[model samples]
Target: MPELNVMSEPSVRPPMTTGTGKPLSVTALRKTYGGVTAVDEVSMEIAAGEFVTFLGSSGSGKTTTLMMIAGFCEPDSGSIVVGGRDVTRLAPQKRGLGFVFQQYLLFPHMSVWENVAFPLQLRGVPKAELRRRVGETLEMAGLSAMSRRRPRELSGGQQQRVALCRALVYRPPVILMDEPLGALDKKLRDQLQTEIKRIQRELGLTVIYVTHDQEEALVLSDRIAVMRDGRIDQFDTPQELFERPRTPFVADFLGAANFLPGRVEEQTADHTLVRLDSGGLLKARPQPAPPPPPQAASRSASQAARVRAAVQPGRLALCPPEHGFCTGTVEAVTYVGTLVRATVRPLGGAPGDLVRLELPAGHAPALGERVGVTAAPANVSVFPDVVPDTESGG
Candidate 1:
């Protein structure tokens, strides 16, 4: 990549929470390929300079949505506005955007300096400016010492850094990263995660990063857009997404959740009592009046949460075998890192009654020991049963 010998001093500012200009907004974006709708009416707002991640499993249309925003895949309908300007029809190059793909996409025969300089050269920048820009970019990527190195000479992390420097050499306001760290090992991925965050912050670049890893999304994003079946399931900050998912799909996708089927039994001033079909009554913080009927109901858990009032009206339906819940004896235990996982049978009649609990391994519980498990009422969620067809929405 071409080295960026930056003549201009770019200020490293605080990570952006809001757009310095108007927010980047996508309105009713839709794309269809033959019989499959790749991206279906996806709409979201990305604050300028904020790192927003599109996270989903394969074939979930996250890549399609990113491509549409980059103008590589034209949307059949809807609009993309950046900093208040509608750029739905703009060419990818003309949009002043930088993109880094999973494969690095560097010319193997080209020197690192040349690779970094390619963007500037494409823009018809002066030779002096190109050299300066590429040199500075190389330094920013921590590769000034290896400007002549080929892709094969560098580590996977370093190669991706070169790709990133290539994307940033022009100092574009927006950057798109498509699984740039996907191929790296766990340690390198962790290292580059910090680097990517630092570079994005230092350059004040608005980023649309895509990945299927929930941990990556949580660690890196100011907000996450969870896509499913060509549509956005939910969009929220990591904390909000984890704590109060608007949909069952969002809750389940972000982490392990316990779901129970229930119906609104009564609404009081401070709580809504719902009767579970699984033989339990659940209390939930009262939702707004005229709340939408519970659809695809589910609840997320940090660990095995206890329901103090759960057994009042009905039996506990499902509990994670990792968190201690259920009335049966401990069947087995597995120690993993700082936590120990125990499986128990709440109902002795079936083998599947195993409830898992996550507890400190320092003072591990004994096997075959009968233990009582309880989770707070607030931790449990009461909702309608899930549909058979839509089992995995997250």
Candidate 2:
């Protein structure tokens, strides 16, 4: 895919800070249903004007946490703070948050202008002011020419744009989007993702967007909270999350990875040496270990053992068997435009265990050919082997 150009020229509109687009803080948020915990102690801070996404598979507690922030779902425990004011118990309408869902919940009978103007009307803005704001918002969304059209008369993309315009027209402090582009086609989704980022930056809006689409999260979010089994496994900038994933679940979910069981042989502040189960010594860079919790600092020696290592497919390259880290036989190879993905079964791995490698289309190995796989130490990520939930993936 071509690199995304999200840093376009800023809009010329004057900064309008309705509700001041203030910072949002979700603290120890908890929710449960029928003896099952849907969200557990979820906590995050979204800076004013920052775009943060809750990304995870279905039932991972991302959506539940978002609902709690929007005041649509009351939490069993925890606080929801917007601009330093606690709104944990506020009604959805009283929380002053704009929300857009996957379904374009436009009024079928109302014209585009009417739909965009609904929130201002509810707030009792003067009729003249409502018309002016609605007109400006419609034009901003490039729907000015279709202002008189009804929902049924517009294309799916246009309808979704109308939904976005409606959410932005009132300029609430923070906007919460739940899979807003989930129903759109790829072309439209890409277009809207660009527009959403542009609009958010132009208006300095603090947005909490939720989506199961990893690419979308990477493209749009200033930071992402990767959730699993009702908890955030890791929250960090896109580059950090992908390059230095703190856990196996995050490493696997963010991209394709090959997990090789290994035991640490030597460690230092910056690097680690591991002996793979296949009997190859591999070097890998290590992230600084987080300070152990006060309660766990005094644990027994066995409880402080080192973990396994993982590497991305893109990081591994094919080389002559004697010169590479591990020797493998290519089981299959498929051309995918710019790259050829080869599935290989290593010499000492169990049957059915395979590693995938993305090679340049011109140099990919033929099926059944013996090859060696190697990666730079910096490209490998080592973490404790915490089995991920069965439901977590791209």
Candidate 3:
């Protein structure tokens, strides 16, 4: 991985008002279309200079929420206050925010300098100021040497840098990015993730990023809002979200996990004992927390009894069939990088349900081998099951 020396470059924009990222607050934001709610009372507080990401699958309201924040998609009811000013009903341009789309959206006919200068020109900036600001932004993005090159003349990454310069040139208080790196390849994506973080830090720019890539969100965000079915399941630091997901969807969405279906036999302050349907028991640390309203407070006694233990594949170990938490027949094994991925079917679970684990390189069980999948109590997260989607909206 490169060191991302972009920050080390001489600062282009002044570290005053231009560098001071304005705080943002979204309250009770709701947007719906055709009686189908897209963003359901979505709200969050983003600090100045914070790098926040809206992470979720397609149709999960992340994009719609972002559009509302950008003033492109107006919320039906709610308020958006940036830097203490209400911009909920303002036009996109009037909100004074930067936006970078999945596509570079650069003017093919305009050179890098002109593209970066376009925003300034529209704001009626003087020629000298526009030229100086464009030059500084291009140099900051490491594109000064290519200022004369058109978008088609540059590589994808370079074009992206140009696009970034265009967004940053005006020094907007907040930069809202919707899968800006989605079009790039993995290698380049990795490189640009670091570069973007570096630039954001150097200028103290507040960034509101959106992406379906879990790894990308984990890599670039200081805080991630994990959305599902039009609402945020959890908003937390990556480590907290991964280590202690509030729901099975958050756990499964953020990482590879094995859900051992079971009913809660006992709940204690320190641990919850689960009786697996596959004829085994699991001890997960602490009790599962019910989700908040919308999906919260709706589970019946029987539905509440139906719970699952969520464990990351990396947290599990394979042992002798009689020695660990549960016994299963090895159904599949595959090599992934330095780790071996093994899938096992519990003795009596439903068909198509399997427990997966990441064994150390060369340590996976052979196919058809009976093995026990074990996890420490601290490694497991228990959540009320969502398989039977009921009125609770699992």
Candidate 4:
């Protein structure tokens, strides 16, 4: 871990009222390690009760940003406003926020009840209130019957529930979870995802979750912030990000996409016409235009920008060579459980250039077969091909 050259110990406590969730705001947050920028001008305005996930691969600055919000890291310049109170300089413990980490972080010798009651005990709550809160939280997590078991004796899922109960015992207005289910197996993780969502909505807690799993982000987030390099590539509802990404990185990150490099031949409010570099004309849905370049640039120069049409594997259809938008030869076929995925090598494309298609099971296209691959224009998203290095990738 890189060192954080930050120091602060504010004595003020956060507002920890329990009821409706509270809003969170991050503005112009930036962090650096030596000369490399880890988080660049990251900003968000999260609504009360909204579950937002920071989705990115490792070292993309998602964790760094979350740490800054939790007061575990210090930002070089930024403001963290939680529930309308600025807590940028506040200490972690003083922030009075809930956190559930990947590791259980439970006390080995303590029973579930003792573990859940720990935070309230530190706050010096009355014994009656502490017991009431702990019991209520345990019940909410469906762990009431096992409240007497020690962490070591419980199953992994149960242990995680204890950790979650511990975080919620204090009824913090906001919760920060860092891949809390990363340690579990797929079945357990899927089961717990539902449990976590149920508890969150039942309590109306504002949640900031961090995860690298695209499926997890899609299943859990009300809105997702897809991070790349050191900046947010896109932040929107899961449906919007998946169906209407404005950048190639966003399209590829949220889900696999085949980017057909091209130049914009014509553009309208609803769609764009692209002449693919491989000698095929294609239509794609128009994305929000990128911000214009400097004032000194010429209009004709702006019109010459390169673009790409991003189509998902599922959207690509295999057809007879003469019927497709472009002709290709089937180079590889993969037997995914419910689908047959085939890779097509375009006739005029480079040796490494390949387009993949997902066909229904039993509709396999034989390897080395001649075919045409095409996708509907409306199903394709078009974006500016030139992306800044900071938003290019993790």
In lDDT terms, which candidate is top?
A: 3
- lDDT tens per residue, model 2, 225-291: 9999899999999999988888778888988578876667787877787777676777788665433
Which scores greater on lDDT, model 3 or model 4? 3
> What is the TM-score of each predicted model, taking all chains together?
0.80, 0.89, 0.87, 0.87
* Over 4 Å off, model 4: 1-19, 287-305, 387-393
Whole-model lDDT values for every prediction: 0.71, 0.83, 0.84, 0.83
> Where does candidate 4 clash, by residue pair?
229-393
Q: Candidate 1 residues 218-243, lDDT tens each?
A: 99999999888988888989988776
Judge candidate 2 against the unseen true structure and give its global Cα lDDT, from 0 to 1.
0.83
lDDT of 3 by residue, 43-106 (tens): 8999999999999888889999999999988799999999999999999989999999988998
Off by over 4 Å in 3: 1-18, 126-128, 288-304, 388-394
Model 4 lDDT tens row, 1-394:
2211111112333333345578999999999999999999999999999999999988899999999999999999989999989999999998888999999999887778788878887798977666566666777788877877779899999999899988887878789999999999999999999998888887788999999999999999899999987788889999999988867777887778888877777878877888887878787776564444344155576455666678888888987888776788898899988999898999997777789888998899888999988778778987666543433545
In model 1, the runs with Cα more than 4 Å from the true position are 1-22, 261-326, 348-354, 387-394
RMSD of 4: 7.4
What does the lDDT come to for candidate 1? Answer: 0.71
Clashes of 1: 40
Model 4, C-alpha of 38: deviation from truth (Å): 1.8
- lDDT of candidate 4 vs native? 0.83
Clashes per candidate, residues 3 or more apart or on different chains: 40, 0, 0, 1
